[model samples]
Target: MARLLRRFAETRPDEIALADEEGVTTWRELDERVDRLAGALLASGLSAGDAIAVHSANRREYFEVMAAAGHIGLRYVLVNWHWAAQELGYVLRDAGVRVLFTDPAFAAQAGEAVEGLDLPTRIAFGDGIPGFLPYEEFLATGPAGEPEPQVMGSPMFYTSGTTGRPKGVSRKRSIVGMPVDVLALAADGFATTFSLPGDARTLLAGPVYHSAQWMFSFMAFMSGSSVVMRRAFDPAETLRLIDEHAITNVHLVPTQFVRLLRLDPAARQDFSGESLAAIWHGAAPCSPQVKRQMIDWLGPVVNEYYGSTEAGVNTIIAAEQWLAKPGSVGRPQPATEIRILDSDGVPVGQGQQGEIWFRYANGDDVEYWGDPDKTASIHRTGGLFTTGDIGYFDEDGYLFLCDRAIDMIISGGVNIYPAEIEHVLITHPAVRDVAVFGIPDDEFGEQVKAAVELVEGIEAAGELPGELMAYCRKSLAGYKVPRSIDFLPELPRTPTGKLYKRLLRAPYWQEASREI
Candidate 1:
């Protein structure tokens, strides 16, 4: 892809490209800003393919920086603002980030992470911070001039690994890497069959750091749709923006959808047929009940896709197909191929539960940034990549997911990614040891549940659950917040101290063990 913004600027210069509460940017304006920002990045000593980490919320600058980086073939590492100092440092160092762009509120926190290292540059947005270059000042150093595009490279996306450390998944989409004919076919199918308009107004409700958010935003931009960006997901504000902007396309995780549905029915009543085009939910499994409710309340416009950062879009459950296969993730997209394999890597027959493996001939392929061994482990000799998710293909060819091959939880359709959550939870003063697992829920499908072993003499304060939840809420998204707390004497573990989450998840599976 030619820097995405460049194509939009050339094709739809006058069209509105981005919209937020602060302001709207036309394609022409966005192109101008990206040019200036790219110049600034170049002036800051960033060369082609050099990594630059961004630690900011969902502001226009976020996309601007991403596009600018793409234009210059500079690697953009979108830092999860929810990460602590240590987590941030690990990613920055691992990615070899030369510069870091962070919000003013997080300047001090980011500073703490880059303390001992010789960081390339640190530019703070919103307000000037001591010892940091202000965003305004950085932009003033370079004039608006289009930077020549370098040879296309892959985008490096770091997966929020729940089991081990986070791994980088790079996706390479060279210039015309995939034929536009295929893209148009897929895009048109999504638009017409799912009721998504080509020029729809979209509001990205979730954090853009994730691959799901980036994919949806990219699809919308490629289709000439206008995006309404949110700094963060607030149910009430999201609803208000939908109404105010007449947003047609809404992409969110199942948790966000649940929250929207939980809003006052009267406020939800304001959303009529024409006001919204389609609601796309993914990143995790959604409850069949929630899907039905969404269809009933909003119309038959709910769509779902099951895929991951490591593996590109594998299967999609369009609205029409969803009614047929209630909990299924539908069939693989046209450009993709999927197979369920047994432990020995042999393909399993239909209706047999096995690991889901995928292959894409034309789309982006999995490229682990620095770990060839990690990359090779997932890819088969034939180029198929195992999703590490246990699912089966029904006779009708729809894919249904079961538990992960690894102990991972999908809370509110956002990957709670247990390891990251556990890492944060273990830092609490009262927590002696902790094991986080996913518990089945009616609305969210699965909720993040933390079973903590409190310190020996510390009396369990009844308010610890609420306090711990509050602490996590401040650092993580609400969906990632642990919904239930269980005080445990000890967590079920192996001799090596690895938690067996299946043992932790057993009690919650009693009532509806095999039901949808």
Candidate 2:
């Protein structure tokens, strides 16, 4: 990354590389900041591969810190902006972060999270915070010279930990230096496969803490593409940014789609969306009905991919291909290998449901930081790792995922996947958000249940539950339909729309004296 910045700074010194609320940063300014940050980190007595944590919202300084760490081969952990202090502390201590960076928005949480830790440095940006050094002051102390022996570093992302404590998904990095354009190459390969334009101009509304959002934002900078980032997501503002910035590519989740599509028609009346070359989405299952409507509205730029943080994205489906297959997550391209195997470790036949396993074609590996026993549990005899996702490849080689293995419901010898039910229910006009899970039942052992959050002004009373059941019955099997639909003001979800199925499923089990 250091080499890449040097090259860019020389070639496109005046070009706008990044734009956020504070305003734009030119390539030259960004390059200088990264060098100074690298110097600051080294002066703090941290060495290559040492970990630092950034628990803040999206901003220019945030990327500067990350790019600096990458230049010096230091692992920068992106702490989730939405995490509570206790949750954030678990990840900080587990990753062994030596330096912590935070912004005023999270100063209180950061302080609480790092309270008793042996942290050597706490740097604050935005407004000054007590017990934290000002960011600019710290940067000014650095030598303003490039650190020697520069090598690449990478961000360590933690799982959302909806089911358990967050685990650090650390990818192994080599100390050996690679080409300056290497980051662009890797990002471009994935972008190109999904129809991201060569002259990509991206608007990132998703928080940078998530892996998918980080790739769309920072990777554009690495590739010399213009990046417009918003600190938070707002449905109407998303369209305005894309239109105003003339963005060519975007990364989004299904929930964002629901919000954008639900906007008043007057708001979307002026949205041409013609500048978009691709609108890639992942991180959760999308409703097929909602997806088709988006394709209708956005002109078929809605491509999708399937992969986990542990495994680099493995499969991609273009807009055209997705229209034909409807629910498939494209075919595996170069650099990734995906396989589906049964519980017995036997390869599942085509179109048969099984646990999904994948790895790089060149045989790279990933591990949970400081948890070998947990790491070893996810690995098979060979190098492949399973994120515990269940899926199958269609006859045409497109991958179709089922629910996570742990979330699959088996009742009376029938296997039920909640995603299918949720997909069906999500298309209902009155249902704003929904989660389907299994609740303990003495007769059936486990029975399908749906927890729904309705749109504003739509009361859960009246025939809402019955209407939803009838609506789902149109597409789902009798046993697969939720036996009951409980109304809630909201469903518990990570910021990215991934459900905390365990949280919704826990109460009934414990009360029934069944172990979960």
Candidate 3:
């Protein structure tokens, strides 16, 4: 891959490689920056497999550092900017990060967090910080004439754990690195598959720390596609960039889609343009209604891929197939194998609800950092890692996810997946968002409970608990319906936009215990 980057620099030195609100960077500039950064890292005594933690938001320096790290085989950890000081401290200590690259906005807080720790070095970008190395000074080291090619782990991305503490998943270059052969396939299916004539511009709006953004950004760089990055998600600014740059591809989360759709309808009145060939949505489930509205608003360019930070790319639901399946996540990728297995590890027949397990023929990372026990629990015998998601495959081989296995509610010997009920509840015109969980019940062991966020105007009136209960009773089975409903203005979500159902369940369980 280092050779590939060098080749691109030699072939199209002046071609634009990256663009942001600040300015654009040509391939030559990017290569030069990476070379200088690599030299600086080596001079700082960062050897192969040494961990360098980056604490920043979306920026070109982040990508440059990542490429340089990958080029030299150093493990680059993309830290979550939203994490509290205590959380950051834990991860830094656990990874034994030798160097920390931080954004100036977070310098004060990050400095406080690492005060007593034996951190190797701290380099602050944008706005200088006293007692810390500035980004520009660090990059002035210049290229060290290319070090030995080290093919160590590429990245250590932390998962947004809704159920427990986030786990770091490290993938070695030989394992998680995307092969050149697969680039042709991805290019054919994802970016400019058919035309491939004009220069492709991809808009990256998500945070660089997340796997979804990393995949898109890395793929764009490898494919020689120009990338336009946004500092953060801003609907108006995002739309403006699309119009200005004529972006051909975009990768977004479902939450971003929701906000973008809510922008003044007039903003999209005559928004007819063929520049956007594809819009990839993933990292969390999208409401069926939301998906439909997106298709209607943006034509049929929406595409969804299902996988985790641990497994790079699992399945892809193309536009044509999405129109047919509606809620299906499409079939597994060509090099992957998926199976629906019962609790006993036996494969379930078609249409049976079971845990989803996947294995890659081409080899993939399948463990959590420093937690082999948990890793073993998930990545079971024979290389099949249980996704912990309960779902079934249709006769046509389409995968339909019900809900997380941990989120399932079992009442009086009846198993219920909250997604089945949440799907129905979200369809209600009055309900803006909803989360379903289980609360303890003496009679049934556990009873279904829902926490809902109502649409704006509906909340002005008093509670409509009875009306919502009646609505659910009419459409769902009496046992499957939520036993109680609590309305809230919003639900807690992870940085990646996944609902924190465990937090919602905590209060109900605590109250039940107090009553007992």
Candidate maximizing TM-score? 2
1-516: candidate 3 lDDT, tens digit per residue: 244467678888998888876788888888878778887888889877688899988777887888788766677888888887777887888788989999887877688778788885788886567657888888886564554453433668887756567788864234333343344445445444322225677888988788888777666665677888977788878888888888888888877777777777777774654688778888887878788888988887888888878776677887778889988998887889999999998989999989999887866647788888988888777788866888889999999888888888888988888887887787677876788998899898899999998877787245578778788888789998888888888888654667888888887788675321
Best-first order by lDDT: 2, 3, 1
lDDT preference between candidates 2 and 3, better one: 2
Off by over 4 Å in 3: 144-153, 171-198, 363-365, 456-460, 470-475, 511-516
Task: Report the lDDT tens digits of candidate 2 across residue range 1-516.
Answer: 256687678987898778998899998998888888889889899877789989888888888897888777788899888889999889888988999999898888988988899996999985468889999889987777678657667888999888688998875544324543466576566565656676678888788888888877777666667788888889998998899888999899999999999999999997877789888899888988999999999887898988777775778888888999998888886877788999989998999999998777666788888889989999998888898989998888888888888888889878899999989998899988999888887788889999999989999898888999999999988999899989999888776767887888888787676643
Local distance difference test values of all predictions, in order:
0.73, 0.84, 0.78
lDDT for model 2: 0.84
Higher-ranked by lDDT: 1 or 3: 3
Q: Model 3 Cα displacement at 487 (Å)?
A: 2.7
Candidate 2: lDDT of 418?
Answer: 90
User: Mind sharing the TM-score for model 3?
Assistant: 0.90
Ordering by TM-score? 2, 3, 1
Residue 283 accuracy (lDDT) in model 2: 84
Q: Model 1: how far is 313 from its true place, Å?
A: 0.8
Best prediction by lDDT: 2
**Pairs of residues at least 3 apart in sequence or in different chains that clash in candidate 2:** none
What is the number of residue pairs that collide in model 3? 0
The true-versus-predicted C-alpha distance at residue 500 of model 2, in Å, is 1.5
